[model samples]
Target: MQDRDDAITPGWVADLAEIGELVSGAYGHYVERMEMLPGPMRTDYAVPLAAGQIEVLRADGRIAGLLVLVPEPEHMLLDNVAVAPWAQGRGFGRRLMDHAEARARAAGYDRITLYTHVTMVENIEIYLRRGYVETHRAEVNGLHRVYMAKRLG
Candidate 1:
């Protein structure tokens, strides 16, 4: 990771886009089955990072993962966690969750929340193992959403 806390740069966005594409499979099946908006593949990630809320996770001295977060009135929203497809299964996701929890605590939030498609069963298990409890499940705009939250100290 870079040693700076500034907003994401254009170069950073490009790097994230590449990783987003490579890691799009995490949501590919759900997106296809539900015809979800944006279709699981992304080229534009600037909207989420526009407020300088995105962070990068590095691997092999290169940009390989992203953690997109947004601070709300009561908690921090873990908007996205993407690890390069090439870099998955190497414990990067767990590390990213740890990073998110640490950052949320530093921001004075006791709770952090995130959501994933219902069909992303593996993701749900991972979150549960990370101490996130299932808050609810809903279908919106033809997409099934499974929401989860973790309370931090």
Candidate 2:
């Protein structure tokens, strides 16, 4: 496992684009089967470093993952999260989640919420193991999206 103490730096939007391509290619079958829209795989929606928001992670001098937080009235939304193809199966994703939770708590936020396609069972299990609980569900892009929440307080 990569050490969490290792330095994690900000990743640029350009890097995120590249990461998105890699992720899309790796998960293209699911994306196509689910009939996702043809456009940018990763959408940049939040301002960088705003209100406990961040969008990048570079671990040990390498692009490790992407994390975007959108501040909300009651909690922060974990809008986007992706681990690099080379870094998958490691603890990097968990480290990113831990970092996000710590930041949200320090920002006085009481909860963290996110939604992911139900077909992404591995992701659901990961979040569940990390203390997230399913809060709702809906069908989007021909796939079931399960919304989850984790209290940070």
Candidate 3:
């Protein structure tokens, strides 16, 4: 991990669980698969946050988004990104994504990779617009996933 502790605000750590709630509807299609996933791992970014493996974005003095990045030998894995529904379409998602790209670049990583559920077509389109190309598709943990990546300049 990149030790993102200093990059995220302190108070926001406690609100990640709350932030996780923002994506509940987006994950509605995965009710069954979600159950297949271990309890805490289901939309919980606690592990990554505590490990300094991700960053959180706040808006109006509150937690509005989260970016989960896992350090890999070849690239930074964009494990997850979620923006509060109320904060959606307000540029928060792009801001966090841009930050993730910069973070990856600064870490000497040439790429950033991520995956979204196939059912979440909107997310797939958003990532595509951000320049992430689909690398392949896979079914993991009972969920159909589309893997994507962006090469950093």
Name the runs in model 3 displaced over 4 angstroms: 1-13, 25-41
Candidate 2: regions farther than 4 A off = 1-6, 13-16, 22-29, 37-52, 140-143
Which should have the higher lDDT, number 2 or number 3? 3
lDDT of 1: 0.72
lDDT for every model?
0.72, 0.69, 0.72
Instruction: Please give the ranking of all candidate structures by TM-score, highest first, separated by commas.
Output: 3, 1, 2
Residue lDDT tens for model 2, 1-153: 332434454545445455566456545656765567422264543345333355556665566676777778999888767777776778778878888888789879999999888777887998999999999998865557899999876
Worst 10 residues of 1 by lDDT: 2-11
For model 1, residues 46-86, the per-residue Cα lDDT tens digits are 66656677777666655556787889999999988867766
Report how far residue 59 has shifted in candidate 3, in Å: 1.2
* Higher-ranked by lDDT: 1 or 2: 1
lDDT of 3 by residue, 1-153 (tens): 222322444324666656566556335445675454422237556667678876676666556677778899989998877676777788888888898898899999999999977766788899999899999998876777899999998
Residue 147 of model 2 has an lDDT of 96
